[model samples]
Target: MLGIAAAVLFFIAFLINAADIATNDTFTSTNVMLIGLTVLALHVSGVGTGWGSRGRRR
Candidate 1:
């Protein structure tokens, strides 16, 4: 679930950057990249979650 959220945010950021490139002469993508990268870091580090439910074992 966390991974899915991160992926969605990243995709949105990517689209924003892409649109900027397609419609303008000035290139600006740093803020979106930073937001996406921060989420990536959290997802990779397992800060809040990454482990499945702890109540069940199979």
Candidate 2:
């Protein structure tokens, strides 16, 4: 529940940042992609994001 909400929030913010960057012609950065990749990494690793942890004894 909490991880999904955090992911959703990150996604929404990423979209807004992308849109904001699209409106500007002088933009020369990969901030949006970095944000997206960060999200992906978090989702994949499931490390401390409320997602399932690997190698747990429980």
Q: Against the true structure, whose TM-score is highest?
A: 1
TM-score of 2: 0.36
Question: Candidate 2, residues 1-58: lDDT per residue as tens digits?
Answer: 4356456656766676766645343332354445555766766666556535456678
Per-residue C-alpha lDDT of model 1 across residues 1-58, encoded as one tens digit per residue: 5567767767766786777565343324566556667877887888767566677678
Q: What local distance difference test score does each model get? A: 0.66, 0.56
| lDDT score, candidate 1, position 21 | 60
Q: Which portions of model 1 show Cα errors greater than 4 Å?
A: 21-28, 50-58
Name model 2 segments beyond 4 Å from true. 21-58
TM-scores, each model vs. reference: 0.51, 0.36
Best candidate according to lDDT: 1
Candidate 1, residue 22: the lDDT equals: 50
Least accurate stretch of 10 residues (summed lDDT) in model 1?
20-29
Q: Report the C-alpha displacement of residue 11, candidate 2, in angstroms.
A: 0.2
lDDT of 2 at 5: 49
